[model samples]
Target: MLPPVKKDRVITQLPQCFSPNAALHTKDGFHPQVKAMCQFQRTATVSFNIAKVIVVGDVAVGKTCLISRFCRGAFDKNYKATIGVDFEMEHFEVLGVPFSLQLWDTAGQERFKCIASTYYRGAQAIIVVFDLSSVNSLAHARQWLEDAMKENDPSSVLLFLVGTKKDLSSPDQLSQIEQEAIRLSEEIKAEYWAVSAKSGDGVREFFFRVASLTFEANVLSELERSGSRHVGDIIRITDNTDGHRRRKRTPQCC
Candidate 1:
């Protein structure tokens, strides 16, 4: 049976981060500008509320298990390898605005690499998952991210590095791998998280973070294009993605 959407996926307030070191937003809540816009501005008719998120990693690294744990709230013990690609649409309401994330679960097998790579285009965010107990999977995270970035502009996408099967790693071993993982995360500029799908720890928070961040980015981009509202001097919404407008010169403050 499918789980109730509101109980599991609805996000009324801004989701908090698990750690400061690996968090995208170090503060407690959404960006001040985003909050103000949502509070004051009338909701625009958004043609694009759905963000595409692609999940990639080596085989048996718990990518499928990690997603199922959040979307369905149950881990499948009888594991079947993902084929070319599988998808799920998760809905959320961030600060009274409706949002959705299109999760693309790509196969980690070598044979399916070509098929999966084809679907990597137009991704708003990339999640590179690895096993907490496997050091080699951690090493391959960079290559996976490189491959995914080829199809989309790097400046437009968000990156997340996730380590699964946290329960399987011992305290000592986890500490060591996490150090390396953190270093790698820093190098790649991806938010890092450790989760245990079987035990249902950190899975929900991780997805919530992803949804919240993507929603914020999309809204900010919309504001930048709309040009009808003003958040601050740092941001100017002049033209939409398809439209072009000349910026009016203003006197510089001395």
Candidate 2:
């Protein structure tokens, strides 16, 4: 049986376009609230979509700090190298759907690269981080990505180029590095974002973006696999007593 989902931090503040009261789909064809309770009881048995994210970068590039800020809402300045790998799980409600992310922080040192590389398999998303104030760290991002991608399906993985410690970089420095980062992002076909783990700037937004993208991709994949209906497919419900008919379709949530 799968382990119970521990109550951790919640990341539910979606954009204004997404309705908080949006309808959610249940497997047993019941109300969402009702299903939520039942789902909670069978937490050990319920199978839900999980997005595995791996963070990689050069040493002291703020990978752990970024994860700390997002997972625990705190940052530690005491610099310590990761031994091999660290794990964190985050639960989120996106568009009225429950989704989880398994975050893996891999060691960035050369000695731990081999050990950390073993944990990179079967990752759905890879976040390559670099220090915004250190051009050399940014220069080594390609290598970090290459190492992490070696064990996973490159085409199937979603990539994000992240610049950490944004608060420490000067405006001119940030602009120059950002341009180069953009160029590299396009070359590597990955999304790019600048964030500061220490100041908690763009950290939440970055993870929210990851959760949203991963959730959408999973939904689309399920739709394709089912092959019975396409996204936005509608169904009609009729009222026989009043001779009235309305189009209503079940919401898709996975």
Candidate 3:
């Protein structure tokens, strides 16, 4: 007899926070609404639940390293500038529903800014990465965010301020930058996180957190859209002689 098909493995637990104040949500698990929706659609598969996430920041701020560390589980010390953009697809199953994230690694160079800006539209999340040890990079975070916001709706996109290379920052430096980062995060309404790609500290947790949050948002959005449509019901539109249109709702006939 043929063996049964194997299912793909995915994360189950909702990743907890590194800092509650700078987190997307302080709760330790998935929201109740998301859980309830999962149960309601348990037998059906949610295809195309992909959240487009764009990573932007000053050049050489370890954007590539951060993404690579989490997605590929490898950290390369060498720095080669990203030309225009790069892409990675990471999948997850949140509350028994399939979800995925399209991680867009954008170039941070001045020359490539124009090239990268074109891909900023329709992003569900924006991750602004900076080197923790470099105060200059942190200072430019706002401008990068501003550039990214040009193509996306501020109210709809999730913002994340990430401080990379945490291992290289001294205690005093780290504390100083962290205070500023938290302030900036609050100002921009972005979540703050510190990670070391080399050590893999906070990398997995951060991405997991991103995946979970994005998945929840996607599901909630679907619920909102589908909420308007009722099963076995339809809308009827009638036109008046005065050029006005009227609508009526009626149940589908058997």
After superposing candidate 3, which stretches have Cα over 4 Å from the reference? Answer: 1-9, 228-254
Q: What lDDT tens digits, residue by residue, belong to model 1 across residues 1-254?
A: 12234755667677777667876667777777788776543344422256889999999999989988988889986778888888777767666555667788888988888788888999999999999999999999999999999999999899999999999999999999999998898888898999999999999999999999998887778677777654332123322222211112122222
Q: Weakest 10 consecutive residues, lDDT, candidate 3? A: 231-240
lDDT of 3 by residue, 195-215 (tens): 999999999889888888887
With a 3 Å backbone cut-off (N, CA, C), the pairs that clash in candidate 1 are 227-237
Q: Each model's RMSD to truth, in Å?
A: 11.2, 14.0, 12.6
Evaluate all candidate structures by whole-model CA lDDT and list the values in order.
0.80, 0.69, 0.78
**How close to the true structure is residue 109 of candidate 2, measured as C-alpha lDDT?**
78
Compared to the true structure, candidate 3 yields what TM-score?
Answer: 0.84
Candidate 2 residue lDDT tens string, 1-254: 22343344233333221111221111223334323432342433333456788999999999989988987789999958787887777766544345677788888878777678878999988999999999999899998898888899886788888999999999999989988887887788777888999999988878877776666555555555656552222111112212121222222221
Off by more than 4 A, model 2:
1-47, 229-254
lDDT score of residue 7 within candidate 1: 52
Q: What is the lDDT of candidate 2?
A: 0.69
TM-score against native, each model: 0.84, 0.73, 0.84
